[model samples]
Target: MNNSHLELLKKLADEFQPRTDVNTRATVEAESTDAFATLVDLARDMQNRLDQQQNRIRQLEQMVETDELTGLYNRRGFLRRVRETMARAARHPENGILVIADLDGFKLINDHHGHAAGDAILRHFGQNLRTHTRADDFVARFGGDEFAILLVGSIPEVAERRISDLEKATSRFPLIWQGAALPIRASFGFTVYNGKSDITQLLQQADDAMYANKHAKRPHSESSHNAA
Candidate 1:
């Protein structure tokens, strides 16, 4: 309890003692009951305020952990979740996969269109991944055109198939803005997590694989500005 609550309680206790000088009277008993009721009211009010404060704190935490544009977990929030997952994995045996994805020709879309269009594309892409993934999976936007997925308890074959399906599904859905259909194509690369490697190493491995995948697609690509 705060000092104010303690002080108010003490004051009430001191002021509302059963009146010994005017005891054996109905008025004195009523006065004592009123004083108890006041204490109860004050305690209830304090508890309500504490609950409101806690709820506000949770809201602030969520805002800080979320990306403003995509409404997905930002890098900080993703990292925190990854750390917690990794720690749990250390204690228990588990298998997971971390995939890093980057939108192909994202800059060209922004250049040909506008930032508004870019924002829409990001939101669409994020929503696509969110709706497709399982409840236990984690999806995050790591700023700009970079996004990630953490597939918990996934086998290598299943994870690969899932990523392939997601890539095809995302490409089929185009964001229509101002009567223009902006196609979304993304390159994804993933690495397995088996409760061993450090976070830095895992991230670097996934990043390298993502770049490699992007490069592999460039040879077969027609135009980088096709999205616009």
Candidate 2:
């Protein structure tokens, strides 16, 4: 029940109680019976309000953990799950894998197109990730153009393969903006956590791997100019 309703009920009950020992011993009258009935009605109303308040609280909690834009878990929600997964992994070892991914040339897409297009790309990416992953997997938008996925009961190899599959699926999905097809791609890096490692360190390793992938794919100045 909501605090306001509970407080009101308490106030009414306090006020209705006999103020003295002599009053408590007096015989009940029709007016007194009517007042008791009113109190019963008030109590029922208060109970209903309390039930509504509880339902509202659950909805608010869900919204807090979800991302409004991409419809995925936001950064705050993602970290909360990470902590929970880490705790579970500590107890069951080798049961969790963390993958970090970022869109390739996302800046170029934003610069060439616009923020609106960028947003569409992010939304599509999120949808694809959700579609390809298992129900037990946790996927979230870590930040702009960056996403993280936690695979429960998965090894690094399996996680990598899942990421690769997602990449291929995403590449095949064309984004139509302003009646034009925009090509999209992503790079991913992952590491397996066995419950013994710090969450921060594991994330860093994945991040490092991602950067290595990006650097390896980047063209040298000569190659760039030649292409131009």
Candidate 3:
């Protein structure tokens, strides 16, 4: 609600309230039937306004947490959820995995294929990630070419297979931009999290593992480039 409407509500509330100095029973008796009905209507109107304000706040929060390009949660939203997950894990005997994936050769693609292709790649990969995961799982785009996935109630072996499936699914459908096919590949690393884990440490571990996986692919990638 606008400030003017808020002030008017306050005024209505103040006008309807029984004064402390007045005799309560006499004040109630002095108010006419029409006055009591008007007071009830005003109270209902104020409640509706308050409900609208709450809804608006929720919508704004959603916008803030969302990534504009990929329609996924942004980093801030991801971290907030991670913290909540951590808190829940502390309270229960649960386990989960956090995966950080970076698009390999993203800078090269952006430089050679232009920003539009880069954006398409990001959007496509993000959608694939969301499609492959369950509704309860968390998926986020942590800006640029980096994304994260949190799989709840998962073991390391299951998490590994899930990541492998995601990698294959994302690359299977190459993005077509400007009548040219642009293949996408991302390196993924994951860390298991439970009640005792720290969020910052978990993220660093996942990032390091992802980089190691990327490095491991370098030899094959270089060989293909040479053959081409």
Candidate 4:
């Protein structure tokens, strides 16, 4: 019963037993029983509220650490993890690879198909990376069409092969946008970190390598014209 009904019952029971006399013992027992029931109901309601609050907190935590669109780790989350990994690496130095990649012709795609299509392609790319990488590997969309991956316990050669595999995967897979198939490709650059280099330096090196790869792949005529 509701609190109001329980209160009314208690009132009637009290009226029947004005004082705690032995003659009204049965009535007092009934009133006490009703009060205990109300207390039990209140406790249950409070527990439910507490559980709801805990669930909300968990959702908030996930939102803080994850990108809403691609479901990858956000910049903040990625950096935090990098720091932790670096600390561990310092304790036990091993081969770790950092790879940076950017979607080729992404600007054209965005310009032609609009941001929605661009977002869909990015989400697809992120899912592909997650599928190919191991559980120990870290992947995040740095921003826009750029992404970064940290492969733990991997050498430079393995890193290169993995990145090449990723590029092939993306190139072969066509992203469907608005019932149309859209071609996508990516360029990658990677550098191995030996647990002694600064994170910033490692990122810069990877970025430089990515640009070098991009430049190397450009047509000779374009390069010559740009030089002019």
> Each prediction's TM-score against the native?
0.82, 0.75, 0.81, 0.72
lDDT of 1: 0.89
Predictions in order: lDDT: 0.89, 0.85, 0.91, 0.85
lDDT tens readout by residue for model 1, 1-228: 999999999999979987665656777889899999999999999999999999999999999989999888999989888888888888898989998999998988898899999999999999999988998888999878999889988878998999999999999999999999999999989999977768888899999998888877885556545532
Q: List, in order, the clash count of every candidate structure.
A: 0, 1, 0, 0
Ranking by lDDT: 3, 1, 4, 2
Q: Better model by TM-score, 1 or 3?
A: 1
List clashing residue pairs in candidate 2: 1-50
Ordered by TM-score, highest first, the candidates read: 1, 3, 2, 4
Q: Which ten residues in a row have the lowest lDDT in candidate 3?
A: 219-228
- Pitting candidate 1 against candidate 3, the one with the higher lDDT is 3
Tens digits of per-residue lDDT, candidate 2, 1-228, equal 899999999999999977875555454565688899999999999999999999999789879988888999998888888888888878877577788888887877788899999999999999999999999899999999999998888976777788889889999997999999988788888888777778889889988888777667777653422221
RMSD of each: 12.8, 14.5, 15.3, 11.3
**Residue clash pairs of candidate 3:** none
Q: After superposition, how far is residue 16 of candidate 1 from its true place, in Å?
A: 29
Clashing pairs in 4: none
Give the alpha carbon lDDT tens digit for every residue of 19-128 in model 3.
Answer: 87468666776787669899999999999999999999999999999999999999999999999988999999799999999998887788899998999999999999
Positional deviation of 79 in candidate 1, in angstroms? 0.6
Model 4, 82-109: lDDT tens digits are 8888888888987798888877777778
Cα deviation of 70, candidate 3, in Å: 1.0
